[model samples]
Target: MADIDLQIACEAPALPDAAFVERCCSAALDKIGRDGALAVRICEPDEIRQLNRDFRNKDKSTNVLSFPFELPEHIPDELKLELSELGDIVICAAVVADEARAQQKNLNAHWAHMLVHGCLHLCGYDHIDDNEAEQMEALEVQILADLNFANPYETL
Candidate 1:
């Protein structure tokens, strides 16, 4: 099972519950054929904006950010056996909610998309170019579909 440490740092009452978050994240991890431990932090816009500015060099708040963990090469192999650390996924609750409404998407489906997107990032998936985007987006759509969610990229 994928180990997820969920941290809800926002005051939004509409945020998804722990079980739903785990199910979404786990589905992504399983689809990507990755097994590990990760953290999911749900925070407010201000916090996400600060993170985006500091790490991504963007001043705006994004819906999600993924920080993949890298173990030092010097660490002994035996030590690595115990913990399969993936990384952290920071999602802005306000941004997610707004985007769901703006996109006319089911809130739960949107949330699943964000979590799956982050999990893919944690597994070294990115869309820096057209080809890469195609690959990643295809995987995302398939994973979401497996979870019974509609294609997130569907036009409204």
Candidate 2:
């Protein structure tokens, strides 16, 4: 299996350490059978809000945002083998922490869920429709279960 190269940038002091974030991302990649490079940025609410507004046209901060890298169809096989860039995932530390608290969930568990969710997005999973959401959510539950975490969708 190829290596999962993770580049993490944390702009918030309250966010988890780089090592923990990397482990979470690596687990997600391993579960999905994808080995590639991805960036995970832990930012302040303001930065995430700006990113959400600029890219998604939403003026509020979300827990996470995923930007998948699209490869050209005409790329040579040789070049494709050397290209490992998957995409970027931006997470709002404040929003994640707040949500975890409000939901009465463990912080680490919620963070792992966010990382897994973002990784799935990079791999072309989305929740735009009911069917898509069910599939994605099921995959997430399985992956999290493998990591010894409870289902995120289950109410406490």
Candidate 3:
């Protein structure tokens, strides 16, 4: 199951439908061997920029932001599985579209990449260091390939 709910807070006439987004998220979850739920919100750049500033302190909008589910400290790891919520992914449609055009990537493919990347982030995969980045990118490439998308990190 895709197990993802999509919310559109901005005009999304050009965005992919929920089914496609679910497929991308599902592929990423399956690659990482997890069964959970996620909330994906498509928002305007202004809202995203505010969120980036408030949460990440970046003060700029980005393509995607992942908020992983945080369990209470008292919750046992074994019992935490009962929650099975992967948290949320927020995508800025304008930023993503601009990035796709600037990076010379297929718009849909770039969307898929962002969804997959967000799913991985929800699963605790990050690219903070070179080794971690390589590992994450390799996994992303493999998952995207499984979904028939080309390598996203390669320059066009």
Candidate 4:
């Protein structure tokens, strides 16, 4: 088994319950495997907007933003590990709620989708193009199904 470091921070008032957060983190780590460390931060809209602007150059608040670490081909001995440290996943609870409503999905399902989506991003999945989108969406469906959630791409 790999080392899993799951951190959940509620930097916003609209954050979900502790139990829900714990479940989300556990589900995410399970899907990502036990090897890597993941940090999930639940933030307010403004906080996410700032990060979106700073990192992605987008001024709007996004549901999730993944900052992946590009490791070199060869790392120092001290940096070598069985599992890698996946970068941070910042999620905006407010944005999530808005999206859930807009997409006509239950809160739990939407949150699950975002958590899985963020974890996939940490694992180097991207959807900048149509082909990538198809692959990523397929993976998302499979993972979410394994977690017993509905297909995230399914329309209501």
**lDDT of each structure?**
0.94, 0.84, 0.92, 0.75
Candidate 3 lDDT, tens digit per residue, 83-138?
88999999999999998889999999999999999999999999999999999999
TM-score of 3: 0.95
What clash pairs does model 4 have? Answer: 2-34, 2-35
Predicted candidate 4 versus true structure: per-residue lDDT over 65-116, tens digit per residue: 9887666878776776644677777888888989888889988888888877
**After superposition, candidate 4 runs with Cα above 4 Å error:** 1-34, 71-74
The number of residue pairs in model 2 that clash at the backbone is 0
Q: Which lDDT tens digits does candidate 2 get at residues 11-130?
A: 544566667667777777787888788888877788889999999999999999999988899999999998988898888888999999999999889998998899889988999999
> Which has the higher lDDT value, candidate number 2 or candidate number 3?
3
Residue-level error in angstroms, candidate 1, position 131: 0.9
TM per candidate comes to: 0.96, 0.88, 0.95, 0.80
Off by over 4 Å in 1: none
Ranking by lDDT: 1, 3, 2, 4
Give Cα distance to truth, residue 106, candidate 4, Å.
0.9
Which regions of candidate 3 deviate over 4 angstroms?
76-78
Which stretch of 10 consecutive residues in model 2 shows the poorest summed lDDT? 1-10
Which lDDT tens digits does candidate 1 get at residues 1-156? 688899999898688898999999889888878889999999999999999999999999999999999999999999988869999999999999999999899999999999999999999999999999999999999999999999999897
TM accuracy, model 1: 0.96
